[model samples]
Target chain A: DAGITQSPRHKVTETGTPVTLRCHQTENHRYMYWYRQDPGHGLRLIHYSYGVKDTDKGEVSDGYSVSRSKTEDFLLTLESATSSQTSVYFCAVLRGAYGYTFGSGTRLTVV
Target chain B: TQLLEQSPQFLSIQEGENLTVYCNSSSVFSSLQWYRQEPGEGPVLLVTVVTGGEVKKLKRLTFQFGDARKDSSLHITAAQPGDTGLYLCAGDGNAGNMLTFGGGTRLMVKP
Candidate 1:
């Protein structure tokens, strides 16, 4: 709670609408990631930022994009929301030795 | 292709029973981590294994990393209702910033 915070804990939107989920971290970790959880697919990585303005795609990066203008903030944007994108989105910051700290997730529902 | 596959996607057991969750991968990792996530919240780190053939324990839960560093496992002894949740395994294959997660194993310990 003190280290990281995710905005818009729950949201409902229609298809084709654009949506953005924000993750603000207090600890200045250099790496941040966005992942979506589905029933059988597990947690699939969408995008990740290694540092300010440096982003890379993960296995499931087709419909998502990420931006990190500052070391403490990373945002995930869905250009066109779809029903398939309706799932829990999680933000994680990486520390040394591959240790990660996760923020409370945001549940997005796209109709 | 999914690198990590978790076994027993869902498990329902009684209190005091023991359960083991596996996270297997073909790629070797620099480190492995176990997390427990409750609904509506983020996954919390339980333990991390960095060395090959390493084992770490937290109370009734035990975590182990494969000798080749390509897999990991978590064993919960004397399960309780509080232990019920979605268990996740994550790792960094080559010492990078982000992690690859397993499909996740959901366990329910009945009272």
Candidate 2:
């Protein structure tokens, strides 16, 4: 499990509301990533953090923002939740040459 | 954007059948990874191939990276019901641990 955990495994929110999902890891991996998986689209990276306070956008970063204040915590926020933004969010920690260890995942639904 | 195209988006076979999933791309990658995801869980890294034309095996599963580093494949021998899940391939082409994922292949091994 790499000690990676995501909070609020399931959430339902109304459109236009703001939502934040949290990812925590005890392994202290320097690289953290947020990805959303949907039908026909596979997993698309939304954002990633290389180190504390050093975050960068990914291929599908629109409408999504991420912050990493500490090595153990990375948060993904939706400023205005939209129906299209509803999907399963996964947080991953890079395990160097071995690859990534992912959290169980957080499923979000917007109505 | 670098894209990985996976063939046979869906597959259903009886237990003990053999199957292979392909992931191809025109762009070269430094490394490729294979992952398997089951219902209600995040993707689990299966293997990572770094050198071109490298082959690796994990029990019933075999992974291969193309000679040009532009493609990869996963072959399963005697698939079982437990093997039924979504398989994803990702390529690492950039820095900061960014990976581009292919559309997943959903496999069902009926017992």
CAPRI-style docking class of model 1 based on DockQ: high
Tens-digit lDDT track of model 2 for B1-111: 899999889999999999999999999999999999999999999999999999999999999999999999999999999999999999999677799999999999999
Error of 1 at A22 (Å): 0.7
DockQ of structure 2: 0.92
- Best by the DockQ measure: 2
Candidate 2: regions farther than 4 A off: none
Q: Cα lDDT for residue A23, model 2?
A: 99
Best by lDDT: 2
Assess each model's interface with DockQ, reporting 2 decimals per model: 0.85, 0.92
